[model samples]
Target chain A: MSRLKYDDVETGATIPERTFPVRRLDLVRYAGASGDFNPIHWNERFAKSVGLPDVIAHGMFTMAEAGRLITDWTGDPGSVVDYSVRFSAPVVVPDDDQGAEITVGGKVKSKNDDGTVTVMLTARSAGAKVLAKASAVVRLA
Target chain B: MAINPDYLGREYPAPEVYEVTRGKIREFAEAIDDLNPVYLDRASAKAMGHPDVIAPPTFPVILGMAGSALAIADPDLGVDFSRVVHGDQGFHYSRPLYAGDVLSTVTRITGIKALGGNELLTLETVAEAADGEHVVTASMMLVVRGS
Candidate 1:
C-alpha cells in the first residue's frame, strides 16, 4: 500500500468517482460470507412478498463497495482511523437491464492539525443516494 | 402477531469474542471483490502504520449481528422471517477494527413499534474488545411485514 502523506492531501480534494455494478450472484456470495440468509437478497418471490419491487442487495454490500472507494483513494485502507455511514435508500437489484449501478465518490471534508483528515462520501444508485451522511477519518503519515 | 412495544429495552447477552484475523479480512475483501492491499498483506499494513492487516470498515456487520440474530429469530418476537425486509442500517466506529482484536457485541432492542400493520424493530448493538474497550456501534432498523 502506498502511504498517503498527511501533508499532501488538501481539504476539498475529491476522490475519483468509481462505479460498480451489483448482480444477484454478488448478493448471493455476500449472503454466504456474511451469514445473512434473508431471501430478500435472493428470492424474488420473497422480496415481492415483503413489498420490495425486486430482490434487493444487502445494505452492507453497498457499504463495502463504498469502502472500496475510500481505501482506493487513501491508498492505504489501514490508515482509516474512523468510518461512519447512514443508509438512506435500498439499492434495488432488478432482474433485467443493467444491474444496480453503485457510484462512489468522496471529498476531503477537513484537514485536521493532528494529522487526521475527514472525508465526506456518497454512494448513489439509480440516481439516488443509497448511502448518506457517509464520512471517514484517515490518519495520514 | 405484533411484537409487544413494551418489550423494548430488552438486552441480550453478548456473543462470544470473535477474533479478527487477516485470513477472514482477506476472505471478506475477496467476497466483496475489494482488492485493497491493507486487508490482505501485513507488510502493506505495516507500510501504512497499522499494527496488522485491518478489516474493512463494514466488517463489523458480522460481529455486530451475533446478539440480534437470536432476538429477531426468536419465535416469540413474532417476526415472520418470510415477510421481513431490511429497512436501514447505520454504523459508528470509535476506532478502526484491526486483526487480532477479540471482540463481542451486546445487542438490545431499542424500540418496537407498529407502522400501519407492519412491525418496526430497532436494534442497537455495541461491539467491545476483550480488554473492555469500545470498538464500534451499529444501529439497524428492520421492518417485518405482518401476514
Candidate 2:
C-alpha cells in the first residue's frame, strides 16, 4: 500500500465509498470485544421494549465501520489523526440472515496547512442517515 | 432520576494501564469486520511506516470505556444505566495507537443537559501513553431516556 501524499489530494477529491454488512453475529462479536453489553444491540425483545423497532447495531460499531473506509483509503490507520460522528439514526439489525448494511462515503472537505486533510463522511443504513457530521482528519506523507 | 448537574467538571482518577496487544487489536478489527492489514499484520504495518500493527481509529473507545465506567457507576452521579444510550462519539488523536503500547486514561464529566425529558451527559476521556505522551482525546455523549 502506498502512502497518500498531502500534495496529491484535492479539496473535492472523493474517497471511494464502501458498504459494511451488519449481522447479529457481528453485533455479538463487537459486544464481547468492546465490553458494551447494551441489550439494545442484541436482544430484539429488549430493544423493542425500549421502543426501538428491532435490535440496533451498536453506535460504536457503526462508527468503526465508517472509520474503516478512511483507513482503507489511506492505507494507514495512523493517517487518521481525528474522527467524529453524531448518531443520528440507528442501524437496526433484524434477527435474520440478511441483517442490514451501512454504506459509507466521504469527500476531502479541506486540506489543512499542516498537511492534514479533513474528510467529511456520510453513513446511511436502510436509506436513512445513521451518522451525521461525520468527519476525519488524516495526515498525509 | 436525572444526572447530577453538580458533578459536571468532576474528574476521575486515571485508570490503570491498558496494554495494547496484537490479539486485542486483531479482535477489535475483526469485530468491525475491518480486514485492514495495518491492524492485524505487523509486516504490512511496517511497510506502511508504523512501528507495529496500528489500531483502528475508534479503538481508543475500548480504553475510554473503562475510564468512563468509573463515572457511570459512581453513586453520586445519579445516572440510570438501564436507560442510557450512546448519542455521539469523537476522537482527536495526536498519534495512532499501536500494539505494544500501554495506555492510561483520565475521564471527566464535561456537560449535562436535559432535552424533552431526556438527559444527556457528556464525558471526555484523555488517553496517554505509559510515558504520559498524549495519544488521543475521546468525547462521548450518552442519552438517558425519560421514563
Candidate 3:
C-alpha cells in the first residue's frame, strides 16, 4: 500500500533522503545477482588499465539504490510505472570496510491527470553526482 | 573495433523464459540492501493488494539484460565486450512483476551513433508474460569506447 495519495502530494513535496553504503563485497554480490560480471566492477587493476581511477560500482547498482529510495517512500514497488537515469559518473568503491556512500533524494515534480506524479531524483557518491536526469513516474492511491 | 552500424534495426527473438521466484526477488532485494518486506513476504505483499510478492522496480533488469545478451553477443555486431560500458537505462512498466510469473523478452537494436570517436548503441527490450501481456519495456544505451 502506498503512503502517498495523489490528492495529498504537493508539487514540491520532498521525499526523504536515503544513503546506501556500497562496498566491494556488495559489488560482487550485485554482479552475481545481476549476471553482470564486468571485470572493471571488481578488478582494480583492470579498472585502472581501462583509465578508470579504481574499481567502480555498477551503474545499474547505483540506479537500483535510487530505486530503493523511491520504492521505500511510496511503500509499493508497483507504484513506480517508469524510471530512468543517465550514468553521469562512476561511484568508485575502494577495497575497504567503509567503502562508499550514495545519497539519494527526490521531489514531486508534477502531478498527472491519471493520478500519477513525476519525481526528479538526485543521487551522489564521493561528493559527486553519479546519476543525471534521474526521474520516475509513480502512480498514487 | 567500432560496433557495426549495419546491425541497426536488427531484432532478436525472445530468449528462454525467465521464471520469477520468491527466492530471486529476495536475493535481489538483499543485494541492493533494500529490506522491503513486500519483496520478501507474500503476506506483506498481500497487504499491499499484490497477488504475491512483488519485485523491486529495477528487478526487471536482471531478466531484461539476460535477454539482450543475445544481441550483444552476436558475432556479427562486432561489439567488444571489454570496451563496452553502460551509458543509460530506463524502463516503462505496464505492471509490476509478481512471483510465479514467467516472462520472455524480444530485443532490437534501435539506434547506433558515433560521438567523439566513441560508438553508442541503443537497444530496447520488450518483456511479455507467458500469455503475451506486455510487462515492461527496457531501453539501454551502451558506449563502446574508442581505442
When sorted by lDDT, best at the front, the candidate numbers are 2, 3, 1
Local distance difference test, candidate 2: 0.90
- DockQ, model 2, C-alpha based: 0.88
For candidate 2, the docking band is high
Best by DockQ: 2
What's the true lDDT of residue B46 in model 2?
Answer: 90
lDDT of 2 by residue, A1-141 (tens): 777788888999898888889999999999999989989999988888878899999999999999888887877889988899999999999888999999999999999999899999999999999999999999888
* Candidate 1: tens digits of C-alpha lDDT, residues A31-103: 9878888888998998886677889898889888988887777787666666667777789998865778899
Q: Write the per-residue lDDT of candidate 3 for residues B1-147, one digit (tens) a residue.
A: 767888989888665888999999999999988879899999999998999999888888876676578888898888887888899999999999999999988888998999998899999988899899999998999888888
Give candidate 1's error at residue A58 in angstroms.
0.7
Kindly give the number of clashing pairs for every candidate.
0, 0, 0
What RMSD does each model have against the real structure? 2.7, 1.1, 1.2
Ten residues in a row with the worst lDDT in model 1 chain A?
A76-85
lDDT of 3 by residue, A1-141 (tens): 447678888999998888989999999999998889999999999999988899999999999999987888787888999999999998999999999999999999999999999999999998899999999999999
lDDT of 2 at A105: 95
For the predicted complex of model 1, DockQ is 0.51
